[model samples]
Target chain A: MAHEVTVLTAGELRGLVQLDLAAVDVVERAFAALASGTVVMPPILSMAIPEANGEVDVKTAYIPGFDGFAIKVSPGFFDNPKLGLPSLNGLMILFSARTGLVEALLLDNGYLTDVRTAAAGAVAARHLAPAKVETATVIGTGIQARLQIEAAHLVRPFSRVLVWGRDMAKAEACAADIAERLKITAEAVADPARAVAQSQLVVTTTPAEHPVFKAEWLHPGLHITAMGSDQAGKNEIEPAALVAADLYVCDRVSQCEALGELRSAIAAGLWQGGTPPELGEIVTGRHPGRCSDDEITICDLTGTGAQDTAIATSTIAAARKAGAGSTILT
Target chain B: MAHEVTVLTAGELRGLVQLDLAAVDVVERAFAALASGTVVMPPILSMAIPEANGEVDVKTAYIPGFDGFAIKVSPGFFDNPKLGLPSLNGLMILFSARTGLVEALLLDNGYLTDVRTAAAGAVAARHLAPAKVETATVIGTGIQARLQIEAAHLVRPFSRVLVWGRDMAKAEACAADIAERLKITAEAVADPARAVAQSQLVVTTTPAEHPVFKAEWLHPGLHITAMGSDQAGKNEIEPAALVAADLYVCDRVSQCEALGELRSAIAAGLWQGGTPPELGEIVTGRHPGRCSDDEITICDLTGTGAQDTAIATSTIAAARKAGAGSTILT
Candidate 1:
C-alpha cells in the first residue's frame, strides 16, 4: 500500500510552531502521560564519533492515545562551528502508532527540540517558580538561552532577564536578542553568581563539563531549571546545589541519575535523599511541588523522548491544519 | 547552511541495489569492521505498543572509514496482516558521519534489512558451511526463508532446497517461488527433522516462541544459521542444540545472549562455553572457522546496527551513482 509522508522543512516548522503556551501545554500533557505509567520510552541510542567530535542520539517513545509516535535523531558536532556550520542539527520521523507506518518527516534542524526543551523549562517553572517573578536569568549563550527566557516569561511574566556565559560577547548577543524579541529589560551579567542571586528563576542551558552555577549562590524564593546535563560529563550545577535546594525534582529520576545533575550529586555522595519525585509527579498533583513562597526548588531537565513525541505530534497536527509541507507518496 | 537530502522510494532503492555478490561483500566488510574493534554501535532502542500489537526498534552504528552512517527505524505490527498490511515496514536515514547532516532517506519498506540479513546468512555459509552442498533447507515460509536460500546459494551453490514451515500450504508456495527464482529443485518437506537431516545447510527464519529445531536433529557436516531469534522470548533452536554443535558462532555474542538462541542455551545451562567467537572474528581471520567439513556448526544471527550502516552507506552510494532519488533542499 502506498503511504503519503508529509515532509516539512525547518522554515515551515518554525512558521507553524513556536515556543508558546500551546507548545508548553503540549509538553505538559506529555509529562502527565509519563506519570500515567503507560508510555514506553527506551534508553537513548547514542553513538560518538570522536574523529569528528560528533555524537548522534536516537530517542523514541510510544504514548498511548496518540495517533503517532516520533523517532528523533539529534546530531551534535562540536567542531562544526569551525567549518562555519551550526553545532547541532537533525530531524524527526513520525510514524503511525496504529500501523507503524511513516506519516511525516520533520526536518526541523533542531528547532523542535529547542522549542520542546524550552517548553519543558517553562513547565518546570510553572509548577516550581515563585508565583510572581520580577527577574529571570539564563546561564549559557546558545539558542536555548534565548528560548529558555522566552518560555519562562510565558508563565512567570518576568520583567527583567539576565544572560550569563563564559563568552561575554555571545552572552551580550543572546541578551540583546531576547530583549528585542520579548521587548523586556535584558542584560548580560558578568558573574553567574550575581545573576543567580538577583533572579527568582534561573535556567541553565550550557553544555559545560564543570559546574557553571554554584551552591553558595542559592537563595530563598529561587527556582532553578538545570537542563544542560543531558549527557554524562556535562555538568552545569554544583553537586551541593541539589542538596541545598528546599526540593529537588527531575523530569525522570532514572534518567537524571545517569545523565543529569543528579549524576553529579550521587557521584559526590551528596544525594542521600532516595529517588526524588519526578516533575511529572508534581504536575499530576501526586507531590506538592513548591510548599511555600520562600522554598528554593531545582528541577533537573535531562530531556525525555515523551517530549519529542508530543511536540512532533502537535507539529504534524498544526501543519495539517495549516496545509503546510509537501506530501510524497511512497 | 542549506543541505539537500536525497529521498529514495522502495522501488527506487530496489532498482539500485540487489541481493547480489556486491551486497554480500558490503555486509562482509561491515562484519570485518565490527571485528576491528573501532565501530560504535549502540544498543537497540525498542518500544512496544501493545494496543496495536506493534513494536518499533531504532538502531545505528558509526564505522570510522564510512563517509555516512545509518539510523534505521523498524516497525513490526503483528496484527497488520489482519488489516491487509504487511507485518514489517520502515525506513533508513543516512547521515554524513563527518558533519552530522542527513544525506539520504531510504523508504525501502524493510527491503534493505531483508537483503542485509540474508547476506549475513551467506557470510556464515561462506566461512562455515561444508565445502560443497547439494541441498539446503530453510525452516520458515517467510520472506527471509526464500532469501536465505538464495543467499546461501551464492556461497555454496546448492542445487536443491527444502522448505519447511508449520503451514504446509505456505511452505509449498515458498518452495515453488524459490524454485522458479533460483532455477533449483525445491520441495516442501512436512517434517523439519527430516529436512535438517538431509540438508548440508539449514537456516531457521521463524518467529517461534519455542524451539522449532531440536538438538536431536544435529548431524555432522551440517551448518545452521538461525536468524529469527532477534527478540527476547523468540527462539528457533533448542537450548541443547548449541552444546550438540561442534562449533557455535553468532553475529554478536552480547546480542545473542540477550535476544538469540544463545539466550535459551545459557538459561538452560546447556552452554558452558564462555563467549563464543563472533562471525566477524572469523571473517577477519582472527578465529579459525570450520576446522573440518564434518564439524557441525550453528550461527545465531540477532542482527546488528553495523549491517544497517553498511547497507545504507552502500545503497546511498549506488543511488547516487544511478541518480535514482529525489533531492529536496532544507
Candidate 2:
C-alpha cells in the first residue's frame, strides 16, 4: 500500500536543539530556488477574527519553490494577561507536490516565525548592508526586535548593539539578554533618535500604527532594515527615510504596497520607476545590492512564502536525519 | 531565549504508529468542531505549474478550526511513471494558531488526504444517508473508491459491495483488496449500469471528463457521493444523474460551482437554487439532509479547509500521545 504516514508532535518538535546558522543557510538556498523559477510562492491570505477586545489575524502562504506553506495563525492584542502567551502560535508544513506528500512538520510555536524573520534580516544584511559593520541600533524590544538584532549580527559582524523600547526595564533586560547569549556588547538607549544616530545599521521592529523612526536622524552611510509593519495598519519608519535612501528593496511589491513600509512611501507619491527592485530580483542578480558604501539602503521585509518554504524544507530534512517521529500505514 | 524552534521530518513522522481508525476518529471530531462553529476555515488557493508535458497542481487550504493549514502539493500526471511513484505526495501540517505553534506534522504522503476525504464521506453518510442502508456500489478503482467503501462500511453495515471500473482486472483486484481489508464481500462488475442499479448507495471516484453512469440505472432509494473531479475539465457522474437526485449537498458552493460535478449540472440548467447548503450546515442541522429514504440523495465533495483543520488537529494529538519524532530547535 502507498498509504503510509509519519507523525510529529509539537512537544517532540519543541524538545530539539536549535540550529540558527542552519536555518539561515536554508533560507539562503530557498532564495536561490526562488530565483531559479523552481518555486511558486504566493502572498499569504490573511483574515481578521474579531473578538470582544481586539482581533486575531490568520494568514497562510504557499511557497512552490520549497513545496510547502508557512501558515501564521495568531491572535492580536487580546489584552488578557491570563492568556499568558504570545498572540501568535502556529506550525510550518513542508509538502512535496510531486508525490502529494507532506515531507516535514515543524512545531515552531512562533519560534521559527521569528527565526525566518531573523533569517530574512540576515539575508538583507548579507546582500544590502556593508560587511564588517560595527555598531547597530535596534528599535522596539518585542520578539521580532530581538530576532532582528541577532540576524543582523550574523551577517554584519557588529561589535556593539543598542536597543530602545517604550519600557526602559524591558529594553535593558533585552540588551542584557543579548549580551549574555550572543556575547555581543549591548546597551539600552533612552531615545529612539539617539539609537538611530549612534549606529551604522538600524533595525526597526515594532507594531506602531505611526512612524516611530524619523527621517532627520538617518545618516548617509546607514543601512536600515525594517522588520515591522507587516499588517496593513502598521508602520515603523517615516516615508521620508525611504526617500532619503540611495537604494530600497522590498520582499514583494504587491504586499509591500498593501502592508509594508513601502505602502506609506508609495502613498506619499514615491514613483514606481524610482522604487528599488524586489528582493527576488536582487537575489537573482538581475540587480545589484548596495551600489555605494556611502549610499543609504533600506530593505523592507513584510515576509514571503519563499522563505517559509525554504526553512520548512531544511527543518524537515534536519529533523529526519536526527531520527524524529513515528511511521504508520493506512 | 524563548524563541527556539523544534523540527520534525517525514522519516520521523513515518515512525508514528497510529492507525487509520484513530485518524478517522480525530477527523470525525474535527467535523463536529466544524459543525459547532468552533472551527474557522479559510479559502483554498491553487497554483498550476505547466511544464512541457503535463502540469503540477498545488492546493493550499487554511483550516482555522484546527488552527493550521493542510497544504496539498502534488505533481502532474507526467511525473508519475518517470519517477516510478504516484503523482501525488505531500504532508499535512497541524498548526495551532492560538500560540502560533505547529502542533503536529503528519507525513502520510497522501494517505491522510484520503483519510480526511473518506472521513468526510462518513460524516456525510452519518447525516444524510439512510441509517440502515446496506449495499454500496462504487465506481472507479482508485484510492478514493476504496476509501468510500470503507467509510460507507463504517457508518452503515454494508454487507455487499459492487465495484465497477473500466478495467475488469483492476476492478477485481480492488474487490479482493477491499474484501481482505474491510472484511466485506465485494464483487467486480463489468457493467457500470448494473453496479448502480443493484445498490442503495453509490459513489463515483474517477478523473473522467464526462460522466460514466446513466440516470436510468439509479434507483429511488439511493445515495450518491462524488469524490473525484476537483478541478475544471473533470467530472464523473452524468448530468442526468444529478437531475434524478432528489436532494443535493456539497462541501462548498463556490468550489462546487467552479469545479465539482455541480459545474456540469449548472451548465445544463439543472436546479434553480443559487447554491446548495454546505455539508457543515447539514451536519449541524441548519439544513436538511435526506427528506425520505426513497428520496434520491447526492453529496458532492469538492473538499474544504474545515476538514483539513479537523484531520490535522487529530493527527497532531495522536502523534504527540504516541511519542513520535525527534525535535531540533532552530
**Quick one: best DockQ, which candidate?**
1
Quote the TM-score that chain A achieves in each candidate.
0.98, 0.90
Model 2, docking class: incorrect
lDDT of 2 at B253: 73
Instruction: State the lDDT of candidate 1 residue by residue for B141-259, as single tens digits.
Output: 99999999999999899899999999999999999999999998999998988888899999999999999999999999999999999898899999888998989998988899999
Give TM-scores for every candidate, taking all chains together and pairing residue i with residue i.
0.99, 0.76
The candidates' DockQ values read: 0.85, 0.16
Please report, in order, the local distance difference test score of every candidate based on alpha carbons: 0.93, 0.69
**Backbone collision tally, model 2:** 47
In the range B1-330, model 2's lDDT, one tens digit per residue, is 133322335455445523255555665565555556644444454555443233333344444434454444333444566667666555554444544344444555555667778877777777777766778888999878888788878777789999999999989999998999888799999887877777888888888898876778767888888888888888887877777777788877777888898898888887576667777778767887788888888888877666666665555565568766544433
lDDT of each residue in A107-182, candidate 1, tens digit only: 9888899999999999999999999899999999998888889999999998899999989999999999999999
